[model samples]
Target: MPIAFDTTGWQQHDRATWFNPGNGDQVTLSYFDLVPDLPASLDDLPKLRHDLAVVVGEVGCLIEAHVVRLGDVPALLQVVKVPLPNQPSGQVFLGSFTVPKADSSAVLKLQAAERGMTGMREAVLVAQLGFENWVMPHPYAPEVQGRLPFHAGDDPRFDPQFADHPLSRLRAWAHHVVRTARVDPRFAALPPFRPATQPPAAQPPAAQAPAAQAPAPQAAADTGAADTSADVTGPTSPADFTAPPTPTPPADFTPPGESPAAPEPEPAAPEPSNPAAPPGPAVGSTLTTVVPGLPIGGYLPLWVGEQCTFWRMSDPEAVLDKLGLGALARTPLTDRRFRDLVALDASSATITLLDRYRAEDGSTGGSVVRLTRVSGQEAHQALTTDTLLDAFRRLGRISLAAAERGEHVTLEPGTHNGDLAEPYVLLAVEEHEGRPVATARTAPPPPPDTPMWQGTAAVTAPATRESVEAGGLLAMYAMNTWGEHPLRLCLTFGPR
Candidate 1:
């Protein structure tokens, strides 16, 4: 009788989900191990090898395997496939080996020799052997369904009503697994699960005009009784032309003392107080208050618009732990808002939170925050060369080098004039172990060169931190084959 092979146990151990073959009373394989010695009665080595290979294939690490004769001994050869550079139609060998029948442990002992191999090999082997029984899948795994009761409002898993549900116990198990699992180095090299794109620049709200001030009271000017002394001048005919003698003041009229009655000094008008600062929303918008234990009092600002201020947590990990924002950190900034707060541009404003004003209950004491735009110099001063270099390094997915010293590649020109649209250049070149394997470039292409001409190209200064922070490089490329081929390309280095 042939031995029946079942991989349900392996699947459950490695993936944490039992495979339902929809059969009743099927005996499931509980464990698989590379026995040190082959059974003397086991005559069909080829059949056993084939069965094991099939199991491995189900987990997607299958490359190729076959039994071959090594001298007088039977040996099994296995090849594990890996990603290659540059050519989508190509693949390079990541791991390849032969396991002799006399040495059953040889395959299990294999280790990767290169940077990319370490992670790839470990991932593959783990899938084949499965983790320990205690190991569980990621907490957020969608496959683990119905952990919570359907009708339990407010997540009854935490309440006494659903204390016995499987979900109630999942949290502690997840924490243990997450804390104890061996971290894969390849994860560090991987790009962010979702990258952030430049958000649309925010338009400033229109400013409101100041309220109208009451008009000041004016004093009446004193004029001597409207020239009563002057003779009423009617239309005087030339015949009546008699020059009126100048009226002399009465001899008895003494000059009034106090210099002819000095005009009463008009009460000095009160100067208006400096206009109150214009009322409007302050500059940088706060996303959420920093979790307790953080040094900063303000909230993390969203990455909105061109300028905004965000709290720089001294201990980000601690804050993230308290707020459960680790998963959110992996997502694109534009996809989620922190505490439902929108981001304000840092360049335009500063945000400060009044944490000391918390209410008696410890909730926010009604927002005592200030957001105000900064001066132009203050807004732009932070984007120094070092700042940009740090940002580029933090991106991890891309790299920047001096254009003059960087490697260049020539591509066949396409059929559109580069002038009409922005010149398209390779934004990034994916590499594996420092070797270029793929290329990602801007869309649209320039017109193809004439039969006799190649293409024109040029490169600007290397991308600075300022440029990248400003959203994208402003470099241009033009291709001409006539005299000298000018290949203007912006090279971005990325992971393979």
Candidate 2:
């Protein structure tokens, strides 16, 4: 059935696909023609549920299932949770509605996977089960030698605890989907569904010798297709779980792919320390000679603001350790203290710290710092010509008036300007002979209390010798945040 729902607060990734802004939760709609092995009759909801459990295997557990209706058409609603095979500590909660017809079916699915609550739920189960360690078979799955008896008190399916849990959120979204669903008149006109005595069999190997082998059925995630495969019985390994490949954009669009390495550092240049004073330009260095990009010689980009500073590091764990928050590296993303100390930004290689320290007034305040890491190639391209132009094309483009005037200019989202609400860049240009040369520096970050939704206030400051140099180019764009982190549309890259 052609279905539509309230997609409020969801960012559309592509056709029939959307993702939650910050949490990495995803939802999609898809159609199927004769799910390979399902009972033909849509009325056999129990069989459908059983088949779902079997198809998901031991790696996943069915939290709930119900025979529901999409408009007037009957459908099966299922909630399943599966741990990601790749991540050390994370689980994906899947909620799906399958509407089956005589010859076709449609599915609307939602996937939510987060760090903090997954760990907490697992810990609660482990503590109650008395498991020797965290890595153990699911408590509710087919019993393993070391698996403990399932208890209703702590079981996520039975317990009404952790209301804000990802699974709980998925269930709520499912209800929203069902309530808001609309059916297509053409689909509803199709013949009613009827069950066959037995499910269809696959073609014999000898019968299809000349043809390519049928690929194994995969998890219906990215494409939103129905998963059709034989029941996985007995024990199943973690590797059996299939996850879709998700693209992660880089923090700066300078390209993370192979490029030339940075040139050797000067003999007197010092290695940039984690929390140390950010390295400065060499003595007698000028904006014309010293341009900012990614730091060379093992140094990182550092932006010191009035309320906070932005730092770039090669390794987040090592830098966090020096900040005395080594434990944060192991903490869940949902922990209260962890969330309090850290704010979500782009890139796992980066860290946004709100340090708890006493100010001169003896009042407790959090000193905010935004840290990001860059590859040698990304840094190299930021200072080069050809690749830099290519990377800038992917972002919202803009042109600064620095070539004609060295004064500050207000920038807003529009044609010839970035898509961000405010311009966070400072440009300085001077005429050399008949040609114009320029330097671009980042403005200080907004105050810690400034609401990001409202956008950071315009920052005006002199260009630093470390800012990127624009010999003749006067273009700029809002830099992209990388990794699975939500897009901030912050950070400005100029001279491309």
Cα distance off (Å), candidate 1, residue 416: 24
Q: In model 2, which residue pairs have backbone atoms overlapping below 3 Å? A: 41-195, 116-334, 251-482, 292-466, 292-467, 292-468
Task: Score each candidate by Cα lDDT.
Answer: 0.25, 0.39
* Candidate 2 stretches greater than 4 Å from native: 125-160, 198-496
Model 2 earns a TM-score of 0.37
> TM-score for model 1?
0.23
Please write out the lDDT profile of model 1 over residues 1-496, one tens digit for every residue. Answer: 0011112222221111122233111111111112223222123444434443343333223233444432222333333322223321112222222222211211210111122111222222222322221122212221322211111121323324433222222222223322322211111121211102223334335323225422211111112122311111211222222222111211111110001112345589899898553232444543432211111122332323222333443333333222221111111222221111222233333322223334688675222223443333443454444433332222212222222224322121222212323343443233446543322233333333321111223212113222221112111222221221111111222122
The C-alpha local distance difference test score for the whole of candidate 2 amounts to 0.39
User: Which candidate gets the maximum lDDT versus the true structure?
Assistant: 2
- Tens digit of per-residue lDDT, candidate 2, span 34-84: 532343345565665555444454345555567777656567676766655
The per-residue C-alpha lDDT of model 1 at residue 109 equals 9
